[model samples]
Target chain A: MSTTSSVPDAHEGARNDQAPAPAPRGPVARPGSRLLHRWVWLRLSLLLSAPLAWMVLIYVVALAALLITSLWSVDSLSSEIDRTWTLDNFRTLIENEVYRNVTVRTVGVALAVTVIDVAIALPIAFYMAKVASPRARRMLVVAVLTPLWASYLVKVFSWRVVLSEGGLAEWSGLGSPGYGLTAVVITQAYIWLPYVILPIFAALERVPDSLLEAAGDLGAPTSMVVRSIVMPLLVPGIVAGAIFSFSLTLGDYITVNIVGGANQMLGNLVFVNAGAANNLPLAAAIAMIPIVVMLVLLTAIRRTGALENI
Target chain B: MTLSSTARRTLAVLTAAVLVLIYLPLLVVVLNSVNPNQSMTWPIEGVTFEWWRRAADSAGVREALATSLQVAAIATGIALVLGTLLALALQRYSFFGKHSVNLLVILPIALPGVVTGIALNNGFRGILGIDLSLWTIVIAHATFCIVTVFNNVQARLRRMGTSLEEASADLGAGVFTTFRLVTLPQLRSALLAGGMLAFALSFDEIIVTTFTAGGGANTLPIWILNNMFRPNQAPVVNVVAVVLILFSIVPVWLAQRLSSDVEAAR
Candidate 1:
């Protein structure tokens, strides 16, 4: 709802025309009118100011400060920030092979997780949306959403156990990939599946049954129908789902620390630099990677109308 | 579309299998919480309530739970107010820079948690010259948590036109009276869902909490992380996880039921 959606005062008065005549404006009505009616700006200001201050002063300013801090560096021995501005942190990030490798590895794993989630979410989401009875659909949604409320650490730790030596994988006669990038990707994909499922299910629900029937009546097979008609409509939702898994995976450090064995992502790099090394400047610089990547991705998806879906 | 029986059968099987796969690991966690072996090795360990008993007695766990509850409650409370107001402003008044405001609201969630963490960490320590504390965490959480409340309230307001509020206003009731009697009643379920979601989100958050929380404080997630590597505490950690996962259903179910009630009314 925005100002444009709000009915004008004149329109409201028009609706009230059918009602019995209002009592004459007494002195008590004058102050109220002066505040809420005579000055629309005051009403708007009262509603808008506090929240705008919070979003701008706290969130936006903090982000801007972080961007500036990335330009500075620290003195190694003293462990104090040098206020002198330089591109040295960015230069180091560029020249360092480990940072370069970690960046590439994180992006690849994020993409893998997104792909895995989409592949799994599609058929299940479609089933929930179209094939299931209404009660069954509601039950399915609750079943999927319950795990989301479960603690994130618990879920990741559960994966750590499953991939542990002599765990379920071994019990079932399948060798576990055992704590590494593979485990990280699997755990990330699993954690984000419900999230991706909901959006895709909503998108699929919007596809009218008549359109699908028309395609089927025209002799197109199920696969052909999904490929041609439903797929196009599903793209925005898919893009929206992909955003959740990819960005969530990219910035995740705790999951990697638990499941990634010796592997490190860009998150680990930043975590180490910030927490372990206490090199905030370097950490802030490293953070630019994911922020920039996400900004670019968000802008690209805005064109697809996936941003609104999100 | 009328699918062949074979195709429908295949899709159904795939969906069922995926659901099973999703729940399998979580089932393991619940079982592990009761396993007798401290090592928690594979192959059918005997079950016992030892971990549950120990977890109940732990002071650290108690303190962590208390901290987590307080943080979530305060954060959710702040988010509820701020998010509702923002949603009201955005939804009711056409204002300049509304698109920018929308982007601002979405960024905290869309950006990597690490980025949000460090940014707030830096701002709290460097720019603001404030100590990292529970207040900082609540603030950080409110920033991100606003989006859920905002989205819910915005959608609710969109679905509910301004007619009732206008009628109240046209009846000679002032703005505050109209909001109190008409608008708030309309917003009750939406607010309930949004507040529960914000609470859930804050309770589960770790990365940003990791950065914002002072050295003295440990929320439940942080507590779990620290205890996970402690050999004696691992099973108790499992028990804690089980409790939380079990408790998760309440709010989610309530929220779902509430929203469905609205739909059924319509």
Candidate 2:
């Protein structure tokens, strides 16, 4: 639409200039307008140059470098990158039961967190979007978002205090399950709840009330109305929220360290190998698992057109 | 649309319960900040402002806070420029690889922070031969921060059309003049909201900062992590956290105000 409209003006300006050219009585505007018309590509290039350079050079190139580095082997004792190209890291990852176990554990925790968030988010988001009055909706939005701004590590530590010995759990007479995989899942779910709530609530808000009315008018039960009508449409939003909950949990090692007791997630494994263990290549290879998982997840959901929803 | 009174009450009660659960930990932090006991076992033996007083006097706390502000500010500035430019170019022109550009912008945040952190760690030290510092942290942050500003600005630009710029050009204004006089006014609020969101994101970030800040820098999250384990300083962390949460309300409100309804929520 924009390109087609701009073309006529470019031509008209050129025509107006040509009609006045070769007279030389006044300064000719022909060259300038004609140059501008012919230089549309240059304008685009200029607009794109800085950002394209920034993204490509800094982000894309760095990601590519990491993938390449993963294929190379690192000397453990020497703490140096060995130039010899080898698939040893990949072979090691496949052969090692620990890596497989950690990957499964990380993916399980992520899925559990996503399911918990979605289940909790659904009702609350529906109530906020559909049941609350205008003023209450505004206040609820603020209430939901405020905690997200609170420092993350602080929140995790807050959880630590709450779950510690003689803390809230024990004080309330419920047995403290203590910090471990269960605590990690709970903490991650707490951390990511707002991210899930906002998106699902936004999608729910966009669901027209008239559609529900139509379903009711057709003599469908409320359960049927929701199950068949609302549920299908809400899947994309749920998936969008799931992506955040899943991927964020996949990459998190800090929460696991603070709250998780002696259990290693994939993030912990990669982190230890990368920095503390001083095996960059192995760390890079371990990192590749999450990268590939995310790529596949992103591609799978791309068809749902939920990327824009995020 | 069709629910009984019992169902409505159930939903409302559930929501209220969730809200309580959400604030429970934060309430603990706020209360623990004033608890006099340095050991910080939950019951609140007594109350005092000793932790706040200590936090005020601590030089290390001051330095870390300063570093966080500096890193967030610089990274936010860079994201604003690069993000707005990217949004404009993508929104205005029909170009090849446009979808690819969108994917590239989202990749840093969505792919997982650990991957991005180590990727940049290798890129900075091995590939680029630059030592890790606050600048490396800023660069890593700006890369992820770009997505927030880009999404905000892109949403605004899509809603805003090219007709106004065309009218300005028809009035004999050049490209820069039209952009300055016409395009920018519409984008002001978007830029403000995006910049604030970017600032908050970089300010709270930890994982990438861990990999990139290297041996010598101290951002607030890093500071909080270090102090959290120390028995005496743990109370000080609660004080800092309560203060940080209090400080955050203003920007969160302002960002919500600047963007339409729930657009920023997205």
Candidate 3:
């Protein structure tokens, strides 16, 4: 209905376009043409300026400030940030055994979660893409996406209940791991499964069934066809999924606080330093670990074209 | 490839099983909200609506819900404008540092949430010389929420070529008028889908909100975190979670419907 009304406006505008050069113009039309048409750069700049300023001034500058803050030191007695620059925070991070242990633990858990999610997502994604009816496939997508909308804290808290003493695990006869590194891995994998699945499902959908049928017709076994065709195509999507789970798990503090019992990760270290200890410089330094790890992962996977898939 | 019948059955079974496993804990949460046991024991003792009644009457819960709604709404609004602008600029113009702009849009979401959180927190308090408040949270959320809106609008713009807008421009309609009448209607469904996603992302977000929210501000996620371990408030928290889970379906379904409608139109 609105489309029909717009058509008449377009026709009226076209009729005006056919008129002589001295046709009456609205008060706003002249500058609007000068701003939007006569000067292309002006138009582009206007469009780009707000979001670019937001990204640069807010995000980029803040990130740079965090890096610079990591080099500064905090006053011991005053708890004031000493403007004088130093590498003491990084030095402390290097020398501290606890930080090292936490870094190792955080990386290990992130990798575990990534691997578990991928392993689970593959067969399910393949089934959804290839085996399900169109209606069922859409239903499956919604089913997967629904959990992602569920509250992250609530999901983790639910895991805490399941892992607590005399909880669901005990009642189900699969005894809880009692809220530690293992609990963190399980809960994180569950929370991030949808993230992993969607990308893989999208990649799998792109694999043509005709090609698969041709492979079978040409006397290739199902396993050979899957290995040669589907798996390779799935790589970028899988990596995209892996990046999400890995990065999310790497920076998680709330999950650890909820179900990790006494265990702490890089996130917990940063949170503790920034919040309870009021040491922003040390917290900034601690944050560099995940930032560096993610940068490395992203750089390594940039060649995979998974970034676009993300 | 043609899977054998046995393999097909196995895969179907596996998928169903995983789906069940995914829903089990959520089911537990829903049941726990009604469980009469204060401790939330596994076996059902008796069902009651006591926790729901308490949650409805809880002042803290009411305030937190208001705060969350306000933050998510404002963040979604800001994100819609900035994200649409960014998407139009990137999609329509080939400019220098274009790839950099793309990367910048993704960085907030790609990097760890804690990293983005603390970076914004520092930028707000340390550099900007402002105290943390609900507005800081809105800023942080809008930053990341830009990606969803950008991705959706960019994809829509890519699919919808410049033909109609060009035709409108050729017809002597001013730029803003053409955009208002022609381009915007095309982008409406995409904006809705993206905005819905951004709202959901903001509503459920906690990590960044924790860093950016002031001492007095308590969003729903923050409230949930604070009350999760409290002995008397735990069941009420479950009731809140149940309500959230139930309400969550509306936006997801609406977004899905809008997107699918667009897809069918295409």
Candidate 4:
């Protein structure tokens, strides 16, 4: 709607070519006009420079501040900030049993979630990409995307009801406490499944059906065709989806806090330290651990061209 | 040449099962919200509007809803304008450090939400000594939401090509006038789509909001989080949860429909 209206102005401008030519020539004969053009260009350049420079400056400052805070140690007695630059906070985090446990749990959950989500999403994505008719494909895509559109909090809250002791399971005659590691995994898997599915769908759509038909003509069995042709081609998409889901789940605070119950993921620990404990330095340090890991993983993915595939 | 009937049936069943799994929990919450009994028991003893009525009357719920709407609207607005400007600038001019600028713009959304949240939290509170507030949440959200807008606008700009703008300039319109008329119209659907997506992203965001919202700023998500563990308020929370879910889904559905319309038109 907006783009269509702008066309006429361009058309009108094209019709006005004769007016600027004579004015420019008259101005070109005067020294003042030459100076005016230079001045105008200079001002325009400066005007553009300010916003661009501001963006770069703010990014640098924010990142540097985070790095500095992540390095600082927290006072043992009052749990207040100790402004000295030291590796003590990192060392303490590495050695602390609770921190170690939470860190491992976070990674384990994230990996588990990524693997499960990819496993579930791949077949459906493949079906939509290869098997479904155009109308059916569109319907399937919309179905997959619908959950992503729903509120994150509402999704988590719904999981609480579904997984609670007396909620969906008990009502449906599948009795269980409903809140534990299983519940947490299910919630995270449900929330992030679309993230994995969308990229894989995009990648699978790029593969021509003719190649698959050729494989089938060569007397390859279904399983053999999948293993030899489809899986190999979809590796990059799988990796991209895995990275997205893994990193997102690793840093998530809500899923673990809501569904994990007694289980403390690293994100939950960071949230608590920052919110309840008011231990900003410790929280900052905890936050840095996941950031560093994500950067390394993403860099590896990009170098492998997996991200570009998505 | 086609799949066997049994195989087709199996695949259809599997797809149906997965869809059921995807939607069951959400359906359960909506059903349980109106249950007369407070407990989320099976067979749904009786349907009632008690929880919905309570949720509507709750001051905290209303306040949180207003806060979330206000913050998301402001954040999305800022993101759309700034992001559109950034996209135009990058599209028009070739300059030094362009790669770095592109990286900076993409970094926030590319990085984990926790990292961006922590970075903003640390920068604002520890380094700048500013208290966390609604403004902080808006700023944090805008940082990432801008990327969505930028991606949308830039993609459309690339598709439209430079000829249209150049033709406008050739006809004697000033750059600003050209932008207002020729360029802006072409970018409308992209902007609208981007703005809606950004608003939805900001509305349901919890991680960044947690870091940037101090003691006082209670967004709807945060309010729900606080009440999640309270036994008496669980059903009421369910009502709010349903509302929030509807809020996000509606905009996303509209955006999807808009994009499909654009595609069909083309």
Candidate 5:
């Protein structure tokens, strides 16, 4: 946009008598001019240094503190800070039965939610992108996206009322299995559904209509057309959505607290440690586990070019 | 080759069923809010707006709402400035470690809220010896909120390209002036969209707030969580939830509109 506007100014500069004409040069410059160019380069680099260094410093320091704290120990009763480094915190997490159960449950719940969300979202996204009328499509997209704006706490809290005995589930003849792994899964799936849906819809929108039509014209079955064309095109989006759901559910503690009853996910454990136990080191240590997992997954996605697609 | 009438009808029924399933819980909340009875019965006997009025009158709920708004606003502002700056720097420059910087920016958002909460709590309280308060909540929120703003601005920056800024530089405008007059105007939509989305995210955040908020520092969501089980407060909780849902809907709707405009313009 600015390029077109600058042409007149460039021409004006060219026509001005005060401005020197451009001098064509080979690889060499006058000594004085070279010195001036070097000075300018030095000044520009100096000007850029502070902000760049500040950003790097902040990132490093924050991460370093977190890492170092994770290695430290905690006094059990008083919850006082102990400077001595030990592997006990990490070992406790690994060896503790409750922590192990929570870790498995957290991963299990996230996976189940991601799978169910993807299964439900894909067909609707496909329909909205390709089959629905423009108005209906718009409405459907809006409907899916609207729930995301609702307060996260309120949404989870609402699920408490909804999944409890004589709540929505009971009203609908589905028995309320109050505050269990099942409720956690249902609520997480509901919350994360839009996250999965929006990206998949965006991805499906990229698939050319002509390709689908051509497939249909070639006597391809609906299933075959979906398999051959749509599915291949949507892999990146689906992966992106799954990553979002998985990571979100993995990190989430609120839903598990409100719905999972006695089930302690990593998030719940972190909260418990931080708030009740004041086991900052152990909490920090547990926190690193999710970050490591996320980084590994993100790196794999980037290598596959799916990160860019997202 | 076409789907028969019966098949299409069945599909339509299935779609409607799923929609109903998705919406039922929300519908129930809305219904129960107005129910005059003590128990939240299915039929929801004799609707009244008393709960809504009660929610408006409740001092604790009002205070929480105000606190939530203030924290969210501050967090959103911080995110908007930092995120836009980072986005511009990453987009305009070809520097070493740019990829790592980008990853770092995205890391907070991708990591679970609990992890972020715990990390920030540890850093602030453990390392810095600072008490958790509204500022702590804002900082924690801004950390994640940065990703939203960065994503929006980066996407806009990619679409816009660097020609404008380069042209401004060529015209002898100072870098700051060029950014203000040229780049800022181009980024207006993204800034607004990002700001609104960030505000929504921060306003609704619970996990981070749960960790960062100290004694006597309760946001609306935290307040709701605490009062959700109380019978007197249950109706108020519903009212607050409805209000919050409405508050978020406006920004999200605006974001959707802005995005659609950008899409169409592209």
Candidate 6:
């Protein structure tokens, strides 16, 4: 629509410019209007250039560098990247028991967190979007969003306090799960619950009440209505929420560090190799597990139109 | 929509329960801040303001807070510009790779921060041969923070349309004048909301900051992580956490208010 309209305006301006004299009538031809109006592609490119450069340079190039670095070998003694193409890092990842264990552990925790978050989020999101009054829904939204703004590390630390050996869990007779995979999953689920809820709630909001009412009037049970009508509609949202919890949990080392006692995930492996061991190539290889997982997850969900929902 | 009273009651109870559980850990942190026990054991030994006082006087906390503010401010400023431009271009133009551009903008955030972090870390140290510092943290933050600002501004721009700008142009207003007088006014609230979110995101971020901040720098989260397990400092960390949690409400509340205001205005 804008394109069609702008073309005539450009032509009209051109026709006026070709006139014998500048008439002191109609819209005055503003200076530099030629540059602004005549060159649509130029303006579009101008708008896009800075951000495109930033994204491509800082993100795309860096990501490509990481993949390239992963395939290269790192000199153990000097700790310098050899730049020779080899699959040793990938080979080591496959052969090493520790890497295999951590990879499995990370994927397991991510799945658990995703499932837990989706389960909790569904009921809360339904109540917030469908059941609550407008005023109450607004308050609930604030309640959900406010916690997200709280510091991530601080939230994890609070969980550390709660799940400590002689802390709230023990004192309250829940028999503290101490700190490990369970702790990591619980803490992660707690932290990411809001991220999961918001998308499902947003999706539910888009599901018109009339649709549900129509289903109900058609003699469908409430469970059937949800299963056939609402649940299918919520697939995109649930997938979006799942993506958040899963990918977030996949890359989280901080939660694991604060809560996981004597356990490591893929993130911790990357951090330890990159930071302590000074092995960037190995860390890059470790990083690939999450990258590939996320790419696959994203591609799978792309067809569901969940990426836009996100 | 047609649930029984029993089901409705159950759903309400579950929501209330989840909300309580959500705030429970935060409540513990608030209590522990005042808890006299340095280890922050449950069933507090006694109440004391000592930790709060120490946190106030702590130089490390102050420096970390300053560093965090500086990084967040710079990163958010950069994100605001880049994000707004990207939003305008994508919303207004029919261009090739438009979908790809959208994906690229979202990629940093959608992908795990750890991957983004280590990738940038390697890029800076290995490929670029630049030393890591607070600036690297800012760069890494701006990369991901772009998405939040981009989403907010893009949503606003889509809703705004180009009618007003076109009208201004037809009236012989220059491009700069149209943008300043027309577009900027409409975008003000969006920019504010996005900027606030970007600031909050940058402020609370730790994972990317971890790899980017390198050895010498400390953001508030980094500070808390380092001091969290230290003897006697745990209580002080709790005090900081309490303060942070309380302070966080302002941006979230403001963003909510601004967005609702936009909705109401419409």
Models ranked on lDDT: 3, 6, 1, 2, 4, 5
- Displacement of residue B228 (Cα, Å) in model 3 is 0.5
Chain A of candidate 4 gets a TM-score of 0.81
Q: How do the residues A11-86 of candidate 6 rate in per-residue lDDT, one tens digit apiece? A: 2243124333233322434556545565777778889999999999999999999999999888878878898999
- Tens-digit per-residue lDDT, A1-310, candidate 5: 3333332333212111334423432222333433333353343444345434534444445567888998998887677989898888889888988777777788899899999999988877867787678888888877777787877777787788787766777877867888989999999998898899888999999999888888888899878887889888999889989999999999998888788888778887788887787788898888887887777877887888876766
Better of 4 and 5 by lDDT: 4
What would the per-residue lDDT of candidate 2 be over residues B1-266, giving only the tens digit for each residue? 48778888999999999899899998888898888777667688878998999999999899999999999999999999999989988888788999999889988998888999888988887678798998999999999999999998999899888777666555444466557768998898888889988999999998888888967799999999888878778889889988987887888777666555546546
Model 2 interface CAPRI class: medium
Model 4 chain B scores worst on lDDT over the 10 consecutive residues at: B168-177
Model 1 chain B lDDT-worst window of ten: B168-177
Return the lDDT, model 3, position A261.
87
Q: Of the candidates numbered 2 and 6, which has the greater TM-score value? A: 6
lDDT of 1 by residue, B104-138 (tens): 99889889999999999988987788998889999
Clashing pairs in 2: none
Task: Give residue B39's lDDT in candidate 4 (0 to 100).
Answer: 65
lDDT by residue for model 2 (A1-310), tens: 1232332233234312334323221121245543553466776787788878988899889888888888898777787889688999999999999999999999999999999999999999999988889889988988998898888887898888888877776687776779899999999999999999988998898889899988888888889988998887787789888988999999998998888989888878777887787787888889999988988888878866766555
Give the C-alpha lDDT of model 6. 0.87
Q: Candidate 1 lDDT, tens digit per residue, A48-108?
A: 8998999999999999999999998899889988888999999998898888999999999
Choose 4 or 6, whichever is better by DockQ.
Answer: 6
lDDT (0-100) at residue A91 of candidate 2?
A: 98
Model 4, residue B197: what's the lDDT? 83
Where does model 3 exceed 4 Å of error?
A: A1-28, A303-310, B263-266
**TM-score value, chain A, candidate 3:** 0.90
Candidate 6 segments whose C-alpha is farther than 4 A from its true place: A1-33, A302-310
Go through the candidates in order and give each one's C-alpha lDDT. Answer: 0.86, 0.84, 0.88, 0.79, 0.78, 0.87
Query: Number of the top candidate by lDDT?
Result: 3
Chain B TM-score for each model? 0.98, 0.95, 0.98, 0.94, 0.92, 0.97
